[model samples]
Target: MTKSLIDILDLSTGEIDELIETANRIIENPQAYAHKCEGKKLATLFFEPSTRTRLSFEAAMYELGGHVLGFSEAASSSASKGESVSDTVRVVSGYADIIAMRHPKEGAPMVASMKSLVPVINAGDGGHNHPTQTLTDLLTIRRKMGRLDHLTVGLCGDLKFGRTVHSLIGALSRYEGIRFVLISPQELTIPDYIREEVLEDGHQDYVETTDLEAVMPELDILYMTRVQRERFFNEADYIRLKDSYILTREKLDSAKKDMCILHPLPRVNEISVDVDEDSRAGYFDQALYGKYIRMALILKLLGVE
Candidate 1:
């Protein structure tokens, strides 16, 4: 009965809490678990280019005293020779004790997990979900604000294709009083399934709007995502909407002092660089928390005390 983290929903609420606690403990005393995974190995099978995610995973394994092996890009691996995901997983499983994979196709890692002998972590599957990132987000939110429940979380920009927002919303839905403000252009509004399935039927109080500043005062957590030019059907439309969503200092003047700003990296102009000096800006800290959470996950999966 091996558990695989294929989605954010794979872990129970209690399990999520435990992981957060473990991550905090590891963060406070890194040397305490220095040899936790001394004899273990982690394989990062990235089928896409992700400098941040790949480096964080490898750094996590290394910090836990574990060895790492894998291809960071699809073209560098057997996939370039036309090997199937299942075949790749089967081969990697024989070499590594656990696998963290990222693929551009939705459900590719799930298919790999079926044939894998070790636990398969979905790093980021297409425009789908990234469970590990969701975990990192949970850890960050809990540590920063001290509660996950009863918070007004605003998800802004690229909702139609932001995998982090999709995954975070799924995980947050299990909590209480989580009112969501989905802010994006008409073209980039949240998908219907998410709105209907998670917001409406899940009975969470939520609203959709294109005006970012109009909803800023109500948000406890402002989660920002990049509005990529590639998502638009027309270039002119992207140019028209890009600056409206960008978070400027003027917009934060009306926001609550305690409201925290978060972004899942490689940010374009969605967040202004000037906001980095704000005390509530947690994106950089979020990246550090990502490494800590990854270290905790590696230790847990490797069965190291």
Candidate 2:
């Protein structure tokens, strides 16, 4: 059977841990795995604009000595000519051993997976899921905090449409003693489905509030996200909420010295620039981990590991 990573739920707890371990090994010994995917090809079909995810996937394949070919935007692909995702994947699967797709539609990758002969990895989908980013978050937490369990993770900013936050919450809930402090505006609260299905179903402990400062002192990890302007329906609404949550160095005065601060990157003003110099700021290191973890995922899917 072929495997595809369309959602974080597609991977079991054990599999995620195994991938993390593989990623760590790759980081420690880069030379040993340089040619692991030699002679393989990866196709990146990004129907949406991306900097970190797209480049990280390309870099991951290159590090494993695999070749990459694909488009960065929908305009550059046959989709611009009204080609369907299924048709796109069906065509690309013949050219590549594996496919990484990022689309604006929620289930675009899932639809592609149904038609793809090769492994299909979802780089991201329209505010729906970003499983790879979840893996990156888990690896970052494990490496920085020394464990995935027994942590109070504070998710600040736009939780409603932040796919990274949604995926991270689902992934972390599988562990023991994982608590969530959801900090966002009332309009930007986590969707009811996630609250009901993930947190409530798992019997996880979580608190919801619009206050980031109040929750700052209790968090073991602070996961920040930008209020995505693209996800907003109204320009006025986006303008109003964009500056609602900004993490400053002053806010860290109440936080634990070891509390790791993470952001999914391409951050607007949600995170103040002064926080970048702090030792606890792990977003940059988190980006580096995205490359390594993605390498593990590519290897796993391509049967190279």
Candidate 3:
């Protein structure tokens, strides 16, 4: 059977640690592993529009001395002509050493994995999960805060549809003393399944609040997510909270000086531009880490490292 990274659960804690270590090494000395995947080819089958994720995968493949081929958006692909994901995977597997796919439908990659001859990677699948992003988050947190354990991480903004938050909570649940402050509107609160399956079952300490300022001082890491206008059911609701949860300069006044701030980019103003100047704002640096980790991922998946 071929291996696939469909979920964070697919990797043991030790494997996760090794991957992070490899990623750190790749970041520190890119040239040492430049030809790691010398003759490999990577096919990125993105069924959604994600500039950052797509480019990260492409850059990763290139840095590993591998070639990359794939479409950036669904409309540009065979999917627009009604090609099934399974058929797409079967076809791409013939041409590439591995396939990384992103789809708007939940569990799409899982279905593709069953048919794929090469390894499959879930770039994302609706709000279901994004394991690679979770891996990137884990590596970023460990690199920045020095450890993932015993940190109070505040996940602020759209909790219901933020796949990154769901994946992060799952990844951190395996660690100890990692408290969460899930800040979101009641309508956009963390789903019942997440609360029941992860927070409650793990017995992790967490608080749900609409107030961002009240939780700012208590956080070791503040993970901001976009309060997407498209996620709201009504225009008035979007207008109200779009400005409500913004992390502004005034709001950061009382926050700990050393607290780290992170965001999955293409942000629609959830974090203020002024806050970017702060040393603790690590999202841009975090984005670069995504590419590095992805480079490590491609090498590992191709059995080269």
- What is the per-residue lDDT of model 3 for residues 129-204, given as tens digits with 9 covering 90 to 100? 7888888888999999999899999999999988899989999888889899999987799999999999998898
- Of the two candidates 1 and 3, the one with more favorable TM-score, higher being better, is 1
Per-residue lDDT tens digits for candidate 2, residues 1-305, read: 47999999899999999999999999999999999989999999999899999999999999999999999999999999999999999999999999999999999999989899999999999878899999999999999999999999999988998889999998889899999999987878999999999999889999999888888889999999887678777899888777668888998999999999999898778889999999999999999999999999998998775
- Sort by TM-score, best first: 1, 3, 2
lDDT of 1 at 211: 94
TM-score between model 2 and native: 0.95
Pick the TM-score winner: 1
Pairs clashing within candidate 1: none
TM-score for all models, in order of appearance = 0.97, 0.95, 0.96
Question: Would you give me the overall lDDT of model 3?
Answer: 0.90
Separately for all candidates shown, the number of backbone clashes (residues 3 or more apart, or on different chains) is 0, 0, 0
- Top candidate on lDDT is 2
Distance from true location, Cα of 275 in model 2, Å: 0.8
Query: Model 1, stretches more than 4 Å misplaced?
Result: none
The window of 10 residues in a row where model 1 has the poorest summed lDDT is: 296-305
RMSD of each: 1.2, 1.9, 1.4
